[model samples]
Target: MKKWFSSAIVFTVLAVLVAGCAGGNTKSGTSESVDANKGEKKPVIKILQNKIEITDKVKAMVADYNAYNPDVVVEVQVVKDYLTMLKTRFASGDAPDIFTTAGYNPMASWSDKLVDLSNEPWMGSVSPLTIEGMTMNGQKMGFPLAFEGFGVVYNKDLFAQAGIDTPPTTFSELKAAAEKLKAAGIKPYKEAYQEGFPLYHILNLGFAYEQDPLATLAKLEKQEMKLADLPFLNNVFDVLDLGMKYGEGQESLGVSYDSQVSDFATGKIAMINNGVWTIDPITKVNADINIGMFALPLTDNAEETKMPISVPGYYVINKDSKHVEESKKFLSWLHENGEKYLVDSFKFFPAFTDIKATDDLGPLAKDMAAYVESGKGITWTQSAWPVGYREDTVKRIQAYIGGQGDREQTIAELQKDWDNRVNK
Candidate 1:
């Protein structure tokens, strides 16, 4: 811990002051659960995570951990809209013992309420990038869940069938490839416009492609820069335009995530804008499908193209909880003993430097890991965007795609929303 992060844990000795503190303790599941046979009570560690995809596996891991250590119990609750629900939980004095935070701006907002895990033993084994993302005021506040990569997940067989030997690495090449795919009677792209995430990824690339993404983000935060003012912001839409032209046109707005991934799996489309997390779902649909991933280029410069690799979320313990130590214990246990669940069961790529990803998570993981190892990956800029920006911006872009507004109108609305919401 000293070698990695030497900061000491500053325990919150003072009781948390809230309107309903007693109710908070009980509702957070920090209260002890009595064991009938032993006539003893076990403290509960409640975790509220956002990834609904891994809910079942997380429950299985919790069961294993509880069985291994009978004196303590751990429970996990998965939610779809995590940030809104997390804020509601804290506002109602019902915060979980441990909850997920995406770090950066969000972590800064919740820093005072998070326990200091700077001196945790496992802290030494994790990646420096993970530490950088989760740290606040020189203190490590969260345990990184795993590394995730997102871009254009494409079908290799379709590319080969189209005579495209080399996958696109630049905006020009991507358009050319799309042309080839279309000429080969293959639908080039499936824009899952029904989902906010894919569209958010496009907008995020506008910032990520900037010379200094953080400085650009600061400008946007301070209203010194607007989304339309971005040099490559139009280029972001150029990529989306390829999808709009070659994909299902306006009907792409009706393509849900499940249907998009399913279509990609069935070779109905050559590529889709998604992440490595979709591998399992796609495999479930078509195990024999050959696939690969590439960076979603935002510019004609090949040098600027890179995959977006990030720690999607991190686990932060509630400083206000009575079972803070127990929550820490559970995290430590998971880090030390949950390799099987993390790798095989959850199909996660370990974010820890010392812990190798033993099983091949998927083809997308392989491509992402290569980029990560080669320093050709970019950080997720949306993590630092305003909390509600994605949801609002996604709708704004969707409205444009749906013919409710033009591109100029979409940009104006997004900028107006940012000005209204950034400071709030």
Candidate 2:
């Protein structure tokens, strides 16, 4: 793989960029629209988050917030290239009043740029995993808005038509289901590998299930172990090859995430391996589409496979924003009285304790909650990887899946890239 952004250069840029993310006295931001119902302008608190699925929902929620509380307005922006754009905004010295962070590793780069949200009133009600996931070195940096999971999101109607009674629970069953769907002349799975997000997700979850991810990462971080030493590299490569072989057309390599979601909603594909966040976009295309979720079965032992569930992002007040207090207040209001509005507005499982959305939960959320409740949920640790780790891993996986590389060589390159990143 080509040498890309090194750890030193990234940290160097982050050191300089955090200062750029500092906001000045004036609030320059993106609001939903003019508050036609209100007579006066309100103090605007801008938000920048990565979940594009909830862009409209958050806009409406903020509108509702504005309607009730006219004193302040919260503007939400959901970007595709969230990390890069956030850095761009920060470097321009026009950071949003509030921003979203993944968790410890990425947040560590900007720890100084975020306000300490340890004292947030809703923190007590938030899921411990959500809170702990965002915490770094005992500092509570942001509010985890949702407890999310990713697996095989499938079409129930399609599965039923193929005589499959339940979602696949084993890697063998998963491939069998895909074969049945393929035989039925339906594209078994949607692929969007040209985009790095899904590509990294498939491999990350595969390896996550095969090892104690935190322990493995700890050993690797200390140079006590090597990626090549991990016994699950073959299993990860197996899943990657499975997807490359049985999924949709070769052109899928160039497909975008939106196209994947849109096509799936139309019932063209039997399943997709993506995060629960894809539900919103799918429902937007066909609200009544029959959907279900199962852990991406990476093992023959159903008992061993765990759903990849964890907090994807957190809301943090920008330390340099002049409206820090107001931004916190707005975020506080989001969790006011159990965040029922948020639960209703979006289908996600709420991180807040008081909200129990049993009846209204979406299919993917229900599956994720079941795993979390049953202690079968695994952590999403890609958030803890180095900045350029995704690109490096994706390139190697892409090469192998493309038949241009072999498993042993791929494993060696991955280990070399990771070791170099850590040592540098």
lDDT tens string, model 1, 65-123?
77787887776677777778888888987788888878787898899999999999998
- Residue 63, candidate 1: Cα error in Å is 2.0
RMSD of each: 6.6, 7.9
**Predicted model with the maximum TM-score:** 1
| Each model's lDDT | 0.76, 0.69
lDDT of 2 by residue, 354-373 (tens): 66565465677766666666
What's model 1's overall lDDT? Answer: 0.76
422 in model 2: Cα distance from truth in Å?
Answer: 1.5
User: In model 1, what lDDT does residue 361 have?
Assistant: 71
Alpha-carbon TM-score of each model against the true structure: 0.89, 0.83
Q: What would the TM-score be for candidate 1 when compared with the true structure?
A: 0.89
Q: What lDDT does candidate 2 reach at residue 49?
A: 70
Lowest summed-lDDT stretch of 10 residues in model 1? 9-18
